[model samples]
Target: MSRKLLNISIPVISVLLGLLAGAVIMLVSGYDPIQGYSAMLSGIFGDEYYLGETVRQITPYILAGLAVAFAFRTGLFNIGVEGQLIVGWIAAVWVGTEFDFPKVIHLPLAVLAGAAAGAFWAFIPGLLKAKYRVHEVIVTIMLNYTALHVTNYLIVNVLSDKQDKTENIAETASLRSVLFENLTDLSRMHWGIIIALICAIFMWFILEKTTTGFELKAVGFNQHASEYAGMSVKRNIILSMVISGAFAGLAGAMEGLGTFGYAAIKGGFTGVGFDGIAVALLGGNAAIGVVLAAALFGGLKNGALNMPLEAGVPNEIVDIVIALIIFFVASSYFIRWIISRLSKKGAK
Candidate 1:
C-alpha cells in the first residue's frame, strides 16, 4: 500500500537528511565530512571487536526501547523507566550481596528481584492513574525523581562501600559470559543480547496474537468504551504500566547482572530511560522495529568514540544527526509529499 510505502520512505528520507546535515555541520567546523562518515562506518562494521561493542550497546537500548514502546501501545506515557531501572539495579545489587545461593538460583533470583522492584515502582503511578484519574505522564515523570533520590540515598547510606560503591557481586549472581572476555578479545558482547532479543519476540507475540493484549489495546484506544463493554479499564492500565516497568527493570538487570557484574551507585540519574523515548519513536513502536532502531542508535553511540580519533570530528555530531533525524521523521509531511509526487510520476 502507498500508506506503508510512505511510512518507510519517511524514515529513510529522514536518515539521509540527517547525514546531509551532519556533513554540513562538519564542513562548518572545518572537518572533512567524508572522512568523518568513513570513520563512523569503519568503527561499527570494520572489525569484530567494534561489531561486538555495537551489539553490547544495543542490548540495553532494546529493553529501554521496548519499555517506551509498550507504554505507547497502551496510550500511556511512562517516563518513569529511569526510576524503574534504578530501582531494579538497586534491588539486583542488594540481592546479590545479601543472599548466598548456587549460581543457577542466585542469578535468576537477583534478576527477578530487580524486575519485582521495578514493577513495584511502576505500580505507584499505575494505581494513581487507575484509581484517582491522575495523568500517567505527570505521575511517571515525578516518579523518576523519587526513584533517583531514593536509590541515591540508599546507595550512599546503606550500600556504599569504603570506596563509595557496593562490593562486587559474587560470580554466582552474574550471568556467565558467552563471548565477552577471552572469546571476543575485550569486547563487551554477552548473553544479554539473546535475552533482549527473546523479550522483543515475546512482546511481539503478546501484542499481536494474544487476547489480553487486545484488551489492553482496546483500553488504550477508548477506556470509557472498554468500561461500557465490560472490560476493566483500571486493571488494564495498571497492568500495562507494571509490565512496562518490568521491561525497564530487565534493562537494569542487564546492566547489573550482565554488564557490570554488580550494581554501582549512580551519582546521578542515567539517561537511558529518557533516551528510550527516542528509541521508541524511531522504532515506530513495533518489536522488530525497536530492535533495529536500538541497533542503529547503539552503533551511533558506540562509534562516536572512534570518530574523533579517526575522522578528526567531534563526537557531538552524532547527537546532532540523531536530533535532526527524529525531527524530520516526526514531521512527515514532506516525506508524504515526496512519495505522492513519485507515485504520480509513476502513474504518468
Candidate 2:
C-alpha cells in the first residue's frame, strides 16, 4: 500500500479495533455490545433534538481540535490550551455582560475578546520558549492550574463578586438562536458551529496557501534551516502560538457565548482541551480530519448519555472505547506492524 494509504488505514483500523475490543470486554462483563452501540447510535440520531445537541457538543470540539492541531503542525505542544480556553471564556463573558452595543458589533466583539485572551495566554509560553529556550510544556502545565484558580477567583471577586456565575449575556451578544431552538425543540445548538468551520478554513488557507504558513512549517521542521534561509524563527514560533491560542480561545467562546451563555466558576478542567489532543491525533492534524474526528467524538459523547435508559449499560463503556481508540492511535507502530503482517499474508 502507498504510504498515505497506510497512514490513513492506521486510524480507521484503530477505530475498528477499539470497537472490537469493546465488544470483547462487554461479553466478558456479561453485557451486550451490539445493544449498547445500537442504543448509542439511536440516541445520537433518533430525534431532531438529539441531532442538534450532538452538533452543539461538536462545535467547541472542532475548535479545540484545531487549536491543538495548529500548534502541533507548527511544532508546539501547547499544553496550556486548557488554561487559555478558561481565560478566553471569562474574557468573552466579561464583554458580553459589561457591554451594550448592536448585535453586529457586540457579538463579534465578545468573540474577539475571547480570542485575544487565549492568544495572550499562549503567547507567554511561546515568548519564553523562543527567548530563553525554556520548554513550552512546563510553562503551559503550570498555567493550566493558574487559569482554573484565577478564573474562579475572578468570577467570585471581579465579575460577579456575589455568585458562582456571571449574569446572562444580552440577546445581542448571545449565540443562542430562537430559530434553532424552534427547529431543534429547544436544544442549545447555536451559530458557533459556523464559526468553527470558518476557523478550520482559515487554518487550511494559512497552512497551505501562504508564505507565512510556509515559514511556520519550515520553522517547525527545522528552526536552524529556517534561520539559515533568513526567516526569523522566534517570530514564527510566537506567531504560531498566537494563532493556536486564538483557536483555543474561540473554543472557549463557544462555551461562554454559545453553549452556556455565561461564564461559571469551574472547579476543574473542562476536559475539552485534553480531548482535543486525541481528536488531533486521530485526525492527523489536518483541518478536515479534525472536523471528522470531532464529529465521532461528539456523537460518542452525546449518545453515551442514553446507555442507561436504552441498553441497561453504563455510559462508561463509551469512555472505555474512546480511551482505547486513543491508546491504539498512540501505539501506531504496533498497529502498523500488525497491518503490514496482514497485508503480506493476504498477498501470499
For residues 87-168, write the lDDT of model 2, one tens digit per residue.
9999999999999999999999999999999999999999999999999999998999999999999998989967999999
Candidate 1's residue-wise lDDT over 1-348, tens digit each? 268766766777888898899899999999999999989988898788888888888988999899999989988999898889889888988888888999889988998888888888999999999999999889888989888888777777887653456777878887647546666567778777888899899889988999999989999999989999999999999999998998899888887777776666566788888878888888888898889889988998888888999988999999999898899878788778877887899899
lDDT of each: 0.85, 0.93
Candidate whose lDDT is highest: 2
- Give the best candidate by TM-score: 2
- The regions of model 1 sitting more than 4 angstroms off are 176-178
The per-residue C-alpha lDDT of model 2 at residue 184 equals 90
Clashes of 1: 0
Give candidate 1's whole-model lDDT. 0.85
